[model samples]
Target: MNGDTAALPPHRPGSTPAGTTDTSHIVQGTPAFRRTAAALFLAGFSTFGLLYTVQPLLPEFSRHFGVSAANSALALSLSTGLLAVSMLIAGLLSDRIGRRRVMVAALLASSVLSLATAMVDDWSTLLVLRTLLGIALSGVPAVGMTYLAEEMDSRALGLAMGLYIGGNAIGGMSGRLIAGIVADHWGWRWGIGVVSLIAVASTLLLWVQLPPSRHFQSRRSGLRELPARWRSLFADPGLPLLFATAFVLMGVFVTLYNYLGYHLMAPPYGLSQTVVGLIFSVYLVGTFSSAWMGQQANRYGRSRVLGICYGLIALGIALLALPWLGCMAAGIALVTFGFFGGHSVASSWVGSRAGAMRADASALYLFAYYLGSSVAGVLGGVFYTHWDWLGVCGFVGVLTVAGAAVAWRLGRRTQPATGELALSR
Candidate 1:
């Protein structure tokens, strides 16, 4: 019934190979499901919490490292780009190994790297360690989705995924906020260490709480299958559009935050790091919005909800032009809400659409998503230079419109996604 496709496969999550007791789980909306989802939410919180903690520290980085916008961006961009690449491997390994183990180890290892990055004395050393951390962080983002598809009931998958993405919203916002606040008071290093400890705690919780995968199969993976899987995914007509949407949406979102901090910190606004950090508390709304949107998508369908979300995004961008500080903050909140909602819906839909290749499909979507972060995160620096905040808004606004248009097309496109329309060459 999803996407109005009658030919849609049974929405049920397939179990692991027959009689695989270690992975057998029932998603009967029980207390167990809530606990599992909570464990996964913490996993997401840890994953993104570790991944984006450095964002608020950018100004301090500039002072300590004496780098320009683009160069300083290397700290974050390198992490996301490396994380993006690592997803491909994580996908392959999860298919061959198991989702729970891969995710657990990924969380643990990344926490170590994050702690290491915090201790580094020089920017060069920090970037090097952060890139490594980014690579290590890739494990969770890569396998989390396939785990949901394999374990959670299809009926509950949308809401489960929303909570997970909601966790991401909270982590991302709080990570940046904490880094900014802690760095303002203690130091950036302490901020990073604090979040790393949080991640360690979350990893342990995930290890004890997450049920083993019941629906996944350890398919023999060779280097050969990777390219073939990529080929198969790209062959889908719907996938290319999905990938493009991922790229544009993520690109615009990262770009906005990357420069917006600098804008608020500079003359005219002259906000302190702590105040700027409070801006990140706006992420709470995103957390709420993502979960709400997911429930709405389940109730009304993704297409309509996606359109509304994107429209809100465009409106949010326009709000940035306002002169008042309150309006600017509200603008940011709207954008945050819109992006998370759109992301949750799009990411969940990929699992449903791919049918069999959920890991690879998730990998591809994440690949686009993080690459957009790296590319646009740096590119927005140019806009930040010329027209200041307004210029940057103009730059991201175009991308938002393009993304919205694509979302509109995706909602209305009824060209049967089965048979010949399965994939595009």
Candidate 2:
């Protein structure tokens, strides 16, 4: 072989080979990319579908298991609590092992735990299973954001991320709906069994359909690296804001959802669990809002879109204070849409703002995201007990306003913003 033709120049880091079109059908928009998106969508759908499946079945759990309101709600609270704690480790694990493997393992294990939860006879055992499932479920969100950041081209990241989130919106809607309707007809056990079965199938589909990560470069793992990564990201001003935004926004969103079921089930409303559960079908609005808002954020600035979304969230939460069911549903829908749209923008902002330490930054943001869920979520119980739905709305609505205020500050800050924060708006 003649040495006349020289070896190709080393490709630039973060640069794909020139003129190679990303034609994957599994991604977003493109046919090739659609399949990829679908796989992750299912992964998103199933993880959340199974994760929050028990939320609407709380009333049935109370009656069957002989527990109180807060205890019945423990099924979801315990899972989110454990999920928040596991995310830190899951992100680090993905950085070392690759996103696909970690995500696949997490989904499958969570599905198995859901199956176990379905069979448990004791309420204590059920909580333990939910917590275990939550721990297993951490693999998805911790790694999914990192995967999107690295795998998708910068030009395509927002749309791709939105589609993955669309999957989440639908999953959250369908999970509660199915659990409530089925539990109403048959029983809570059947409800759990059905969702768990779907999760098992979805796990297989995620593993089989999602492509292996070609862009990921596994990192060197160590405890020292964790602190170093944490410090490095914290040193970046943009990251701390992103992390805090995740915490506050998520806390507010979960708190509203955590107690909404209780409010609808009580005196004034006195709605059947199935009817109340169907209200969560409004989460479909999030699917539409996320995709459209993401596209607009890509065109405009993410910070700008995010502030508007948060404002909408505040307005919606305030409106829910009204007595009419129609107004309440509308308000919930607005808040749901705003939450998804804002999350889509902010979460992507974290990836764009962090520069080369993207995975670490994403993980930290999610760590805050889950911690908010676990902490504010349980604390929300106090508000519920003392003040009822009005109290819950006030607490959550204020957090939304605070989140918007932070985003406003981040949006207005001056230049010389180091790293990806300075990337083209």
Candidate 3:
């Protein structure tokens, strides 16, 4: 057996070994922890890079395919909608097979599909490929979260989750920037091709670098038991709220970015595709905020940090409503910072609260997350079409306010005995 898996004695599924609790986890500062973080970071990068490569190209698609903004957005919405549904199946599959295997397969397969997407010319065919890409990519996020919660030391789990999400931030920005810039010089096809190629490289590196699962125990429970497990997760005091937060946070964030290019590319600004894509550089703030707010959550409390994130998001929206271009830029940066930080806090909270049902819980949280992305992203386009930028801002503001209320309610709840940080007073 490998040294990683050799340290722990065997135990029944869903139960910890009597005395190996601390030793079973990958502690911070150890080689295994570093390997796991590196692999997951690459996984996050590849997964999101492939998933969102088309975002910056939506206007291009609209012009080429002779579709409206909302129709062009189907390129992203279809993928996210299917991804939301597919993650549940991926979660169950991971429990039966293994988290590492599922994530590796997903990254490789999604990369290949992205390469295929770059070759397609027809509009419907492109949507079909994007939808399939969503399904293919579903294996990474939920399973990755489950793997972290199961294997990482409780004290270090927040930071691990944050790092993984930080990778997501960078991947998303790089994908958009590369695609936008390359599309200006060559075409959208070449842009997607380049991003797909990068995804393949990241996937290959992750395969070699990721250590095998050390703490995962295979569950024999099949789909028949899924309902009961999900019921239990929903019955928990905090899990449902965390899931709602995921939905609102992702929805608001995606809606803002989905329409931003359209807004800036229009009459007054007349920004080029490359310049609009460069604006996504604001996502760099997300890379910082995800890791930083997660550590803050570990110290100050998840709910308090989460609430502050929502406040920042609201402030950003207010700034975005201003007609000034610099205010809009600053607004985008603040929103990016808040959304990533909140997601980190909420996701880590789900893991801590779910206990034995972490896999299902993670899947549910992401399902809501992407579902929001699909639904609200499309709706924002409708608002933009009718009323322009203010309409979109108003729409996102409503969602942000609702999310803040959920965070406040969560703050008032008593922490469970599961070693989660207490809610800040």
* Clashing residue pairs, backbone N/CA/C < 3 A, model 1: 16-214, 23-214, 235-423, 235-424, 236-423, 236-424, 237-423, 237-424
| Residue range 68-164, candidate 1, lDDT tens digits | 8777888899999999998988888777767887888899999999999888888889999989988988889868877887677766787888888
The candidate, 1 or 2, that scores higher on TM-score is 2
Give RMSD (Å) of candidate 3 vs. truth.
2.2
lDDT string for model 3 (1-425, tens) is: 22223345664333665665556677888998899899999999888889888999999999999999999999999999999999999998888788888988899999999999999889999999999999999999999899888888877788899999999998999899899999989999999999999999999888888887777777777888989889888888888889999999999999999999999899888999999989988889999999999999888988899999999999999999998999998899999999999999999888878878888999999999999999999999999999999999999999999999999999887465365536432
lDDT (CA) per prediction: 0.81, 0.80, 0.90
Output candidate 1 Cα RMSD: 5.8
State the local distance difference test value for candidate 3. Answer: 0.90
Q: What is the per-residue lDDT of model 2 for residues 178-250, given as tens digits with 9 covering 90 to 100?
A: 8888887888888888888888898888877776665566677766668877898888756787788889987
Top of the candidates by lDDT:
3
Clashes of 3: 0
User: Which is better, 1 or 3, measured by TM-score?
Assistant: 3
